[model samples]
Target: MTSPTSRRTVLTAALAAAAGAGTVASAASASAAPTSPAGSSAAPGALVDNRFWHTYTDWRCGTGDGTRVLPGPRPGVVIAVPAGRTDYTDPHTGRTAAWDYATWTSSVHRSAVPATEVIASWNARTPTGTWIQVELSGVYGDGTATPWFVMGRWAAGDGDIRRTSVDGQGDPHSSVWTDTFSVDDPASGVRLVSYRLRLTLYRTPGSRLTPTVWRVGAMASDVPDRFTVPASTPAPARELPVPRYSQNVHIGQYPEYDNGGEAWCSPTSSQMIIEHWGRRPTAEDLAWVKPGLPDPQVCHAARQTYDYQYEGCGNWPFNAAYAATYRDLNAVVTRLGSLTDVERLIRAGIPVITSQSFLKEELTGAGYGTAGHLMTVIGFTPDGDVVANDPASPDNDAVRRFYRRREFENIWLRTKRYDAAGKVRSGTGGVCYVYWPTRTTPGQQRVLRSLGLL
Candidate 1:
């Protein structure tokens, strides 16, 4: 959904339309910025950089109602299976194989009626007929009251909605009836709409584990461009000279593996920023929050009422508060979706640190590949140039440099995950931050301080 020209108009429309609406109102009134279930809705104090506020909406998923448009921005689902393997087994396969798989089934409804039921099955077969079964339980949402439809099979094969039924290993699978939903008029002040799709899977006997694969399609819209990673090349090294922020303070003072796991992008980026500041950072100093956190099992079984597993990364800003942390740093996580927002932050004097390579693709449409991998925005150049620190360049050597304003804006929105795909799908929103020590000492305090726990 596109942003309205004025917040006043949008707010008025939302409030008026929400009078009789139930779930729709909940989403439109979602926090303007990051928030926890228990936190107040008032604006945050130290979010110092607020330029990316609107990016959250731009990256919102599922026909704009939150189901997250699949193949639209991120992977729809992820499954892990345990099994025994030997030299002949391709253990690393992402697809389901004979040794094991999983099954999920669900019944969903729209406006309180059974809308549809579905079962998705996936698996990988070995030449020897040994195989694993993987299944998906899903509900289809056309953004109307009808719950999304799902089809399940006991055997591994394609499931079709048009067909009355597909063959399955004979087992009793229950049936659920759902309702039909429709939003016939947008002029009725209800342009945004949604539906439900709940799913789960059951296993068949004798298979070591279930190996399965399930493909999903929108009954009303096209499949999304979920897997595209944009590319961009940085400017030629000679023209833009990097600048120096703190000549005496070298980032090498800190290193990766100090905070979160280094394999993921957010943690790795956070580690780089802390090192650049010539200060050590701890997990306490920065909040590494993401959405849909703490798998169902972790949340249910955790000992504490406020379990970390239940809180997911989307709560980073809150974690910052919990950790008694100060200052958050990292690149524009949402790509082109937040350019105007970043501009606002840089103007706020927040000492934003990020990689120059990120904007490279934006400058040169999907043009990726460069060595100036990690850089930070130190200050604006003369005549309003965007000054940055390039640690990789020989001339810059972590020195600050400048680029044209026009070029910077163009590149900003182009490189983010949101910009790469225009928005985030449900259960896929992500956040990143760096934890730099307030002082140059290494201790648990640094980590706690960054996380705001201390």
Candidate 2:
């Protein structure tokens, strides 16, 4: 049913809106330089830039049409008035209807590290019959502009519209592959120098319902192409008490969501961390799952994060958005510089979900190879090896694994690697999902701040 090498894997692989395409709105706000994901370091090796607009001022600076900035412990933007109405056809369901909509566009942001790839993420509360669309447009180093690419169409639940991502979007400079905005060829030296995000919220007509967006941002990077990455000695060895769920156990249970369980590494890992923070779907929420199934919440996660367009549950930002839907939890899609960064979070009692691709022999003890996969980094061994909850295992009992430090780091941090056939392919270059609670312990805050995650 799915292509073997389609951008969805060797085992696997990796939206939107508005009937009125003629509507346009823009505003003027101050611009700022992007900050490195690891910190303010200007090191040449600091190739990742993370810029998010979340504070009250961040919302105030946006050019908004019928949008209001909510200020408090957590500030966000909601539709105060409908800017206009447009009919959107749910591509998955083939249902077309009209809805009132408003938009908030961020001011232009210049990347501190000019990027060859970019991925956008957001945290929002979309009530029933409501949803939000996020888009990114940017300028190249040559000052040439790129078309606005839809990053995601999201909602907290599936009662209204099927959450999805857009495809076939690109310009001469770049193209959007699944959820990532990538330069057609990074070897040409052309890169996205800066960008802006646009959030369009929609709800049923004449209803006061609005989607409150708490955070919206993107991670832009220009990681060097290499078969390996620089190694680092581990720090403060500590293993987190993270739960594990094997994707293989449910292989044929819900084939409708990304060909069933075999391709659910992203959502599976997400559910593990979400519960690590003590949140889960209610019985009513799990009512849809048939009885006798172990960890139905994993099924719930698969459905909640399923992307109709991509036809897979591996969308990076969609997984992060799913985690944020829980109370008091905040999640972002970012790139870390090294395993030391992951070690810092582990010491703070936080486990991280990381994206990478590797051959079976490349990572000793991994029974299979994948073009794209996600694993939870729970802790480290005394020998500095990686302790992971690998969802690809045959059962929950087989989920915990200790991968050799040198071997795991190269597979997880490298931007390029050779497949089983020895053909070169792109790596995630340290892309990960970092989730934490709104109320964090002092130790958590201190470690998060040290890594620039706060």
Best by TM-score: 2
lDDT string for model 2 (1-454, tens) is: 1111456223121122221132335433222423222233224567887777877888888778889999999999999999988888888888888889999888787777899999999999999979998988788888777666778888888778888877666777677777888887898999988788889999999999999999888888888887788899877679999898998888887878865555888899999999999999999999999999988999999998888877788888999999999998889898898898899889888999998887879889988888888899999998899999999898999999999999989988998788777777878788899999988999998976655456
> What CA RMSD would you report for each candidate?
19.4, 3.7
What C-alpha lDDT do the candidate models reach, one value each?
A: 0.24, 0.82
Task: List the candidates' TM-scores in order.
Answer: 0.28, 0.92
Per-residue lDDT of 1-454 in model 1, one digit per residue for the tens? 0001111111121112111111111122211222211211113332111111111222222112112212332223222332222121222222332222222211111111111212121111112222222221222232322222222211211121010111111111222211111122222333212122221222223433322212221111111122232233333122222223221122221222111111111222233343444433344322332334322111111111111211211112211111111122222221112223334333433334343223245433323333123234545543555665533332224344565555554333222233234443211111222233323334533432232212
TM-score of 2: 0.92
Q: 189, model 1: CA deviation in Å?
A: 19
Which parts of model 1 are misplaced by more than 4 Å? Answer: 1-141, 144-269, 275-340, 353-374, 395-398, 415-454
Residue 271's lDDT within candidate 1 is 30
lDDT value for model 2 = 0.82
Worst 10 residues of 2 by lDDT: 11-20
